[model samples]
Target: MNGAQSLIKTLANCGVDMCFANPGTSEMHFVAALDSVPEMRAVLCLFEGVVTGAADGYGRVAGKPAATLLHLGPGLANGLANLHNARRANTPIVNIVGDHATYHLQYDALLTSDIVGFARPVSAWICESKSAQTVAGDAARAVQAARSAPGGVATLILPADTAWNEAERPAQMLRDIGPAPVSSQAVDDIARLLGNGKKTTFLLRGSALHGAGLEAAGRVQAKTGARLLCDTFAPHSEVGAGRVPVERIPYFAEQIVDFLKGIEQIVLVGAKPPVSFFAYPGKPSWCAPQDCQFSHLAHPHEDAAGALAALADALNAPAQSSIRVPLQLGGLPKGPLNAMSAGQIIAELTPDDAIFAEEAATSGMPLLVTLSTARPHTHLPLTGGSIGQGLPLAVGAALAAPERKVICPHGDGGAAYTMQALWSMAREELDITVVIYANRSYAILNIELQRVGATGAGAKALSMLDLHNPEMNWVKIAEGLGVEASRATTCEEFASQYAAAMQQKGPRLIEVMI
Candidate 1:
């Protein structure tokens, strides 16, 4: 078999059956190999960023790596911002980037750049196949690296000569690397801390926020009177009214400092040490109290659920009764819009089992409290803090759980980053209700300007952050991309449109003019 065929078969063997791609001339042979292999489904993207970001979203919801095929360095560069976000979110992705042939590189082509240098910041593992015989081996390794730990991006650069050349049979199966076990000593330390009855909180994220892990945490919290908080920007949070009710650490440093004021100890479970996302001039980077003792009950790679379960037993906490969920629709807003907002829509229109992909930027802050009342729903925030992740994430979530309604509450500025996802939603018939907050400017950047003390800026300086030039008409944009669209000017209209969109089959877009 040719090297490209071997690589394709290897990825399929590893259970990565879907690929998002934007190819160029250098990838012709790989494209040809893909054509012959009907088992692998390649979804086309107009831009490389869409391809990479879609793969990132797929991994976030699917819990496995998805492949991305891009033209060499320039293409990878175009996708780097989203890749950076993927790296931060730790979503597993296998990037197959096509490069110039060995002989062609000596001629100094315009497309050439330092591919490895560009990939290092985003990829946990990166390699370029030296020969056809090694392509399959590299592909297998890339998959393994991507699937490791909390999941990560792995890039494999392929030269044109290697793609058309003969290679050995592809790896038929992947090695299973189970989640890491928690350290016995760490558990023992945390148990002692909880015994002291001092003011303490258990901070959890990633897998610790869901399933058996969260149940274990609830039991522990119920028995011990310890508080539980999730990281502010977690990729997926298994939350809502009845499901443990974790308080997220405040995004602002001052608020966090106030929250942690008298806390004696902080235990982390599958989460990093709590800190501000950005630094304020006079504030300390770390938000926890200076005297607070820090401990990790379970690291990200460790089996958080197992760790929590074992810790609960060690602490002798009783298993709590199953929580109850109310199966009713919340009341809708009335009258004209008048800044009734995205938070209001989420609180009023969120159906049971709704999945929310929130990339609403600053407009999302109010949603934290209002939607906290919405029971039995899953909320996924932009883990990597990348702007364009929402729509694609909604697509992936809809595809992942077809029975559940996926709601994407997005800011118009951020939505523009990967708006092409609307086309994919239409093509794939994903059950996603995309609600765009049409403020028509990067409102978050305006906040950032003041937060960073950029006051009294000139017109041209301020104009760069505003998007009112043509004032993006999201309704038209969604329709142009083949998705059915509507506009809602008030909270009542938004709630009505959102409910209608949620009940309907296939993709729909709601432009909520906030």
Candidate 2:
């Protein structure tokens, strides 16, 4: 068997059956091997970012690693932004990055660059396969690294010669490595805090934000009267009307401080202590009150679900009554076709089971608040704080959960970054409803300029923020990308277009002229 064949077998044995790829010449052997392997499905992507982002979505839903096939350093570089998001989410991903043959390194070809340097920032574990005999074993190690604990990105760089060379035998498949136990001392401290009876919050994150861990948090909250909050930035949050309703900590520092003001203790479960996004003038980095005692009940790498279950059992916390209620959307203003404001459109456009991919920047804060009371849905925010991820994430999500309607309520500035994803949506006939908040400028940058105390900006400095010497023609762009497109100037048109897009089978775009 060839090294590439054995590597593919290793990946399949480790449960990574899906591969999202954007290949190059160096990866031809791997690609050929993938074609020969019947069980593995390789999804092609025009951009590396889409491949990585799709892998993130698959891992979040599939609860295992999805392999990514990227070219050399430049290809890996292209995918790094989404890898950042995946790492932040703790989504398991095995990356197979192709490299120059061992003998070709001294020649310093055009594609030759610091692939390992590029990978180290985003990957939790990285390895370079030296020979064909070791390539399959290296791939197996990559899968294990990705599957470790709460999950993370693992990269295996394979030289062209290594992939093409012959392997004597296939690598041994590895067994499941269970999560590390929560610290006994940490659990004891949390027990003491609960016994004290002061207002405490057990903030959830990582896998603890889903399924049984959520239920355990609900039970604990019901018994102790402590509020339950999710992490400020989560990889994937499993929230709905019927599930234990978890309030996420606000992104704004002052808002988080206000939220945590009365709480004397904060116990973490697969979450870190809340902190400010940036250190503003005279503001603290950490959001908790002066006397708030911080403790970790379980680390991110621990078995968060098991730990929470154990805590619930030890305390004998009763199942929450609120956990089994039907979903309800509160009364929202409608009917008048006034200014097609963000608030009005949000209330009118939201559906019962929509998956919201929001990278709406500043204009959507009001939308976020309003939609919190809207029907139950999976809300995916830009977790890594990167601007361009929303569009690609929306595409991947729509493809992954095809049965559920997907909504890409995107900020125009951020949407432009991965606007190419619209083409993929069109090609795949994904059920995606994209609403572009075309405010004609980088609205968030204006806010940042003010925050950093930069004042008296001239027309030239201000001009850089504007997207309109000629305003962006999003409808034109969408149509060019092979998706059905429309423009909306009024609330009625916005609502009509949004509803129409939701009902359609293929990808559709509505450019809301805000």
Best by TM-score: 1
Write candidate 1's Cα lDDT for 1-514 as tens digits: 9999998989988898888888999898888888767778888877777788778777877889899999999999989988987888888999989999978888888998889998999999999988999999889899999999878999999999889999979986567465789877877888888988689899987788877888898888877888888888877777666787688887888898998889898888888888888887887789899889888898888888888888888888887724423333346666666333557666766777788888878778877666776757888888776688888778767766778888888889999988998988888888888888888888888877888777678899889889998889988999999999999887767777877876788899988787
Clashes of each: 1, 1
In candidate 2, list every pair of residues with a backbone clash.
89-235
Which RMSD values do the candidates have, in order? 1.9, 2.4
Q: Rate the local accuracy (lDDT) of all candidates.
A: 0.83, 0.81
lDDT of 1 at 425: 85
State the TM-score for model 1. 0.95
- Per-residue CA lDDT of model 2 for 1-514, tens digit only, reads 8999998988887778888889999999999998767878787787899888878777776688889999999999999999999888888899889999999988999999999999999999999999999998898889988998878999999999998999876666676565888766666667777998688888888767777777777777777778888866676766556767788788777889998888988888888888998877766788889898888888888888778777776777785534542454444344443223545566555767777777777766776665665666777778888778777777767766778888778888888888888887888888888888888899888877777678789999999999987878999999999999999877667767777776678889988777
- What are the models' TM-scores? 0.95, 0.93
